[model samples]
Target: MIAAFLGMRLYSVLGRKAEHEEEIIQGRFKQEEEARDVPPPTATGADSARVEPVIAGFPPAIERGLREISTADRNFELIGFMEGAKGAYEVVLEAFWQGDKEELRELCDDDVYQSFAAAIDEREAMGVTLDNKLIRIEDSTVHSAQLDGKIARIAVIFVSDIASVTRDKDGNVIAGSLDDAVESRDIWTFSRDIRSDNPQWLLDETDIG
Candidate 1:
């Protein structure tokens, strides 16, 4: 019986079916298994595999054009155009307050500037001040940019909250509080036409009404 049991354990160990139970059975007859089980070799390209970098195509001309257009389009931003608008608004607002048509000649559109200036003059003749306050930018977006010939017409959507105030020449606020802001929106199109003599950037026109 002992020999038969020892023979069975040896057969199981040689067949690679020597579990802890087989070891116990063989050890009972003072026999040791030839080899112990070990984990399988790790498969290559399984975990932590390095990936190859993808090659991207390059179009130099198209890339350059896109960059140039992006740079020109930046002029329609709030802060960028705000500087010019602030200056223009200051002149227009003061002229409107004083009713000075001559001061708005080169600063604004002819008809609109003249009409606004006339109104200011009429009010000033009556001892009135038109307090125009530029409050906050409600919305701003680039409407369109069309490249025509060698020029680009960039249209921008400008919207803001403005408080038009009225003061008595003494600098005393008579009407319209700073809190009295109203929504005002407009589409301003600026044209940049390439020139031959200058060969530089120039503002050809600004839509005003």
Candidate 2:
């Protein structure tokens, strides 16, 4: 009779403890499910806005240069050469957008290439960050041309803005500067001769201010 009484008490105590543990586990599971159902915070301000489209186009004179795009004759190839030069200009725009030096080198002439590369190197050395937000081919005009002689000159205008942030050696931003989104128009001259086997014309010169 004594043994039966002690066994019954022990069994009652264990059953209650098991029920308490089960309640704690169920409570924890409920809290976790509630957290999972909660929605994430929404983004605000400009961060939520859509990005603007990139715009690029050439002037009327480019069509005139395209006249020589024919491969049948050397004279016609001269026109192709001018068109090729224009294409190089477009390539430079792409490089600026992508922040790539190699791409610029392929399209830029020796002197111009050195100037641009040096600027990039200096900025990198000083921890300066550069951002080119916009590049637009605004206008272009034909300066002079001699299609029969396989030589042409054209002026292309482009507008672009650059933003720079200067940083210290420790990579801390010190000075930030932005060129007031000014209208920058560049005039690029192109020339080539018929007798020259070189189908691609050189960038004779450029006036950028």
Candidate 3:
């Protein structure tokens, strides 16, 4: 996971899928389940049966984009990016819950920052506090990826279990059960300016599935 505050520059700052559709917004918030039955690349290179760079699980277009990303950013690694996404997910949730605009600023784009800030403000104004916890990240996968001009973006799906509870100023249980962990699916897009010195991929957009 990223730090409580995103102060690290480059990769640490901006670095980091779903089911149901025809259009795959590689960098936008869209959903579609591709050929997931295909397996990932295996470690057993001696066996000629293993495809070195497996493309079985990804849709063709997305697979092509992944190749482009690798060509564009030598530092890009599918596994590393997946792990980074997990951390970023946790950081964003914690920051949003705490209404930490400073932390959000470094991690998300201006529009997203404004949206989260507004939501946090509204929740606070209502004299309500949310206690949210990420119980576990069950799965993570890429839904789409693309490069527009010098910008590169990838949308990912995070399957997770979360425990949450909301309380009024009087501390009365309001929404969500404190004891139950709810399953959730989130699609988020992260983008980075490939031509720039900045390595951070900002949180460009999000959608719930």
* Cα lDDT listed for each candidate: 0.40, 0.39, 0.62
Worst 10 residues of 1 by lDDT: 21-30
Model 2: residues >4 Å from true position, as ranges?
1-74, 77-87, 96-99, 144-153, 159-180
Q: For each of the candidates, give the backbone clash count.
A: 3, 0, 5
* Model 1 lDDT at residue 50: 20
Better of 2 and 3 by TM-score: 3
Query: lDDT per residue, candidate 3, 1-209, as tens digits?
Result: 11211212111222222122122222221112123221211111122123226434688898888667666765556664565666778778877877787767766666666667766776677677777788998988998889777677888888899887777789886766757998878888877666755444667677775
Instruction: Assess candidate 1 and give its lDDT.
Output: 0.40
In terms of TM-score, the best-performing candidate is 3
Rank the candidate models, highest TM-score first: 3, 2, 1
Error of 1 at 69 (Å): 8.0
Off by over 4 Å in 3: 1-57
Candidate 2 has its poorest 10 consecutive residues by lDDT at 20-29
lDDT tens digits, residues 103-161, model 1? Answer: 44534433344345445555656565556777766666555555555454444455778
lDDT of 2 by residue, 90-115 (tens): 55544543457775554444544444
Best by lDDT: 3
